[model samples]
Target: MSTESLGHNSVDARSNGLFGVYVHWPFCAAKCPYCDFNSHVHRGAFDEAHYVEAYAQELAHFAKHTQGRVVQSVFFGGGTPSLMDPRSVGGILDAIAKHWIVDPKAEITLEANPTSVEADRFRGYRAAGVNRVSLGVQSLREGPLAELGRKHTVDEAIAAVRLAQSIFPRTSFDLIYARPRQTLDEWQDELTEALWIAQGHLSLYQLTIEMGTRYYDLFRAGKLKMPDEDLSADFYEMTQEMTQKAGLPAYEISNHARPGQESRHNLIYWRYGEYVGVGPGAHGRLLINNQRHATATEKLPFEWEKRVHARGHGMVTDDVLTWEEEGDELLVMGLRLREGIDPARFAKLSGRKISDRQINELKAIGFVETLPNGFIRVTDKGWPVLDAVVADLAA
Candidate 1:
């Protein structure tokens, strides 16, 4: 029942692997200028009790959708879930476990920034059920951190990473590369330093000027000066070289880890597997019986909380995927993995074969190759230009 393209939905078939949960705690101490994620800053008194109940209700709603499947993972994502009270994290996890069948070795992860205040809560989080931690140590140098608008310093990041390693054996951190005025040599040195300290995995992102982000505005206003494209490419090459030498391979375009240490939660998405998403702005794709369901939850906290209080639920949108839409979705998500897409899975998802016309065109352009089993994958030459290639395949 494993799928390549459309996605196979026959095994557990009904299981559709529809049992992972994601919790979004959307409050940050400060929003970075370059960030475009759904995050807001707040330090005043708010409804912690009400918020915890809302989270519980969201879990209950998903429990109804996925009645008997075992949840493989539960991820507590940003705006800094670490800022939450450890008790709140526990309450929600307890609710999920009570309401659903969680895998015995379920991987529970929390995303945190490197502030000491958050670090102090690490042990409490482990006690609460978090077995993995992904620290947001965007940069380790003082100037680079300030440029990225991070709240912590190099020493503080090191300290937080050390604390996380001490608490959770599976710890990882992210580093943003290709910044304005950043040199390849600088990144090489910095990466070398970070790699020396990384516990198991490292997420390296090439900074891009995303629309509506402060970085984009600054660049458009001629205020954000960055390295040229050539320089950025140079730095990416250096990153690959250094990371491979460190025994961490880039399993995804942006994530690298020691063998078998890849983020299983994220793999579910990139591998185009089914998962349930809860909380504000979270998304999920699930398959039940033989149908696909797309899920989304409330965005603003007030709107979400109101729904929670009124009907014991807070959701924004949920829709079924059209066959063509499912095809497009598979094409988009499948390419993120190194294994590429399986044509048979596509055939199963769409109940029809992928046309040789498009496949031939992509192959002619050196973007795709077919395995003996007819599974297709993006070639190494296609990785640097992946977005355009996905667009072509989807189109």
Candidate 2:
């Protein structure tokens, strides 16, 4: 990794050992109809070179408060990180190592689309310090992909996963389920096929209608037909049953992995650890000098770059957490994991015990069960009913 200062920024590494860095690349070949992530498709031009510099500048800004705090992981997530030049990624990694005490075994993961244009960057990413790869192979079947607005062919997805496994020892890919008219038999066969190709991990999600997406618009117009709740519930239960038998049990809501192969980067978020977010519209959570903070950068490309050039930051907001805010954040994120919350960990952030009244209410409702190990966990029975539980608990 090579190094450079995009601009002047001070660093203080003794913040805490609970830190990590996130770099966002905000361009995708095409935005899926259902994808509401901060991604866009370019028609004419993109300033990749200048965008890379902006990322380093933003990182330099945060590293000051995060010096000596061990970077537990670095996730290259986005529009499509695979679209980035290997040199740009290399330069960023070098700069990170220079300013922060990055753990040598730090988990570095890159999210990629399976097209040849992006897949070809795998080896370069590995060379650039990314040891793990999460390919967005959203479907193993072609029809669902076409319906979902993805560009790659099924064969292309298969090839990309195979290539990724060859290049990196740890690989994870995703599959979207619960499509309209998709039967249990069809999805069961696909899952069977996926497991044959799966390596150490997988992320399988039940499709949901996000408000601003194209699907949502069509849904509002009543032109699109989606699976009913009953059918969707069956698909969700089937996924849990199948994945558990395959030995890659669900570690979080939608993520599954073999023992010790869980996604370290995602765990950073689910575990409520600190990380730096750089790039258009990326949000990060950090704790600095005993104060927890939420950070988000400017969302537009031109605006983010200009802001970075001016004040050496593109931050849209930098906010410290209130006790109620911290509790809400902790409960929401903590429940995403199968392990639920470690009471002591909750106490560390909120400086108060988790309410036994609330715990008893949830247990009584069959939403969560107390474990013998002293960790509270969501029950398999409560998986589908999670949103209601979270909302009531928060209320």
| RMSD to truth, every model | 4.1, 3.9
Per-residue alpha-carbon lDDT of model 1 for 1-395, expressed as tens digits?
A: 11222332234442336357888888889989889887888768897877889888777766665666677888999788999999999998999999878898888999999898889999999999999999999987899899888989899899999999998969899999888888877888899999999968999999888888889999999999988867877887788778888999787878899987888888878767778776777788877556678877777867777887776667676677877777777878788777778877776776667778888998998988887766788876677788888787766
Q: What is the lDDT of residue 87 in candidate 1?
A: 93
Which pairs clash in model 1? 4-342, 4-345, 5-346, 6-346, 10-13, 12-15, 180-226
Residue 214 displacement in candidate 2 (angstroms): 0.7
User: Number of the top candidate by lDDT?
Assistant: 2
Angstrom error of the Cα, residue 283, model 1: value is 1.3
TM-score of 2: 0.94
Q: Report residue 142 deviation for candidate 2 (angstroms).
A: 1.3
Please state the error at residue 148 of candidate 1 in Å: 1.2
lDDT of each candidate versus the true structure: 0.82, 0.83
Q: What local lDDT score does residue 103 receive in model 1, on the 0 to 100 scale?
A: 93
After TM-score superposition, the amount by which residue 327's alpha carbon in candidate 1 deviates from its true location, in angstroms, is: 1.8
- Candidate 1 residue 377 Cα shift, in angstroms, is 1.9
Top-scoring candidate (TM-score)? 2
